[model samples]
Target: MENIRLGGGVLLLVLLAVTSLFVGVIDVTLQNLVDTTSRPQALQTLAESRIPRTLALVLAGSSLAVAGVIMQMLARNRFVEPSTAGTVEAASLGMLLMLLVFPGAPVVVKMLVAALFALVGTALFLRLVRRIPPYSPLLVPLTGIMLGAVIGSLTAFIAYRTNLLQSLGAWRNGDFSLVIAGRYELLWLTFVLAVAAYFAADRFTIAGLGGDVSRNLGLDYDKAMAIGLAIVAAVSAIVVTTVGSIPFLGLVVPNLVSLAIGDNLRRGLPWVALTGALLVLGCDIVGRIIVHPYEIPVGTVFGVLGGAIFLFLLLRRSSRVS
Candidate 1:
């Protein structure tokens, strides 16, 4: 049954990806796919815009999903992921700092700096969570959100003070419109991080059971957490640097997978990846189709749509418990 659900999710993701091919600000007809000379506009749209956007969507989705799974396991809280934990906000701050310090640094250099700060932020988050009593799983996310808000506010203040608000807009809004051959290279880094995530899945699952249980089971709890934090930071950095902050992706996708397939990380990772890809790609497609000539940012769509879904889930869970 788990395999069936997983397979279904994968199928949905593929369908979404294919649908993404058809969706664009410009209308692309079937004849356009066949006759390049006749439909030069369509050909250019598919080759330049749709393809890169689709790649960005898939990479962002899978990376964020996997980051969420690792983060939730490390924190022993389903709701604690990079976005909630201030990792993404910290990365944005790092990029801002790099910009301020260097004045004209390349994107790669900025991304590395952002990634380092993100790691630090995640480590701080884990330390904060450890200090808090774990009885209230809900409090974990609340604390994380508080931490993130603080960081986000600081970022906004800096951007405002530095008069870099326009520069920051690119990172604040998650859009794949800028992705191209040279620019999109960073997203592939997420693929490497995803592979590493799978290798450490067992340790994460053990750690999630609690530090004491993991220690008793002969797993290095601290080491596992450090590794998890690194993965979360790296993944969050890559996604934010590549496509900007995608709010609620890490929170929504993995939790949805957990609902369908228990809490087993190994068993649930694939589904999480697929569902993340599907959700983001589908949202991107919808955003493209809705505005016709202009495109809505994927982050905005996810913010509104994912928020509603999250609220529904919270309500449903509350009712079930009641």
Candidate 2:
């Protein structure tokens, strides 16, 4: 039954991805691919724009969901993710700083800088969580939110002062309209990191039990944490640097997958990835057609959906506790 469901999900994702290829304004079709004359433009659109954008949707979706699950493991809090934990905000700040300081820097340099800041920000959030004598799940995410807000404010103020607010806004909001073949390659790095996370899942799960417990179980808790945070940072940075942040993605997908499959990260990870890709692809497709010639950003569409889901989750949790 489980296998059946998983297979169904994969099929759904494949169909959605196919649907995504044909939904863009340029109107790519199989007929275009078959006909000798129309093949050139259709192939160009698919190769240059549609395919890259679709790949971006899948890569970003799966990787962000994986990163979210890893973060939840490290924090032992379901609500904590890159966005809430200041990781994404810090990464965005790093990119902004790079753009300001070294306007001529390569994308690689900006990505590296953003990853560094993300690592530090994620580390700080974990450290703050550790300081609490007895941690509360609610409090952990709230603290992270506050930390992210502070980092975001600093980033915004810098952009304001430098008169680069427009540039900052572009990188801060998740939008894939501009993605093309050469541009979105960075997200593949994120996919590789997500795959690596699967291998490290057991250690991360043990480590999430807390330092002393994981040590007694013969796991190097610090190493596990470092690996986890590095993955998170790199994933967050790559996404931000390449296509801007997708708010609540890392949060919503993981929580939803966990609710369905339980928090066994290793077992549920693939489903999380598939579901995420399906979701983002579906959302992007909807955004493309919902307004016809003028398309809405996938970020905007998913942000609205994810926000409503988040509120529902929060209220449900509160009610359960009461």
Best-matching candidate per TM-score: 2
Counting only residues 3 or more apart in sequence or on different chains, how many pairs clash (N, Cα, C under 3 Å) in candidate 2?
0
TM-score per candidate, chains pooled: 0.93, 0.97
True-structure lDDT of candidate 2: 0.90
lDDT of 1 at 150: 95
For residues 73-150, what per-residue lDDT tens digits would candidate 1 score against the true structure? 888776777888889889999988988898688877888889899999888888889888756667888888999889
Clashing pairs in 2: none
TM-score, predicted candidate 1 vs. hidden true structure:
0.93
Best by lDDT: 2
Which ranges in model 1 have alpha carbons more than 4 Å from their true place?
1-5, 39-41, 320-322
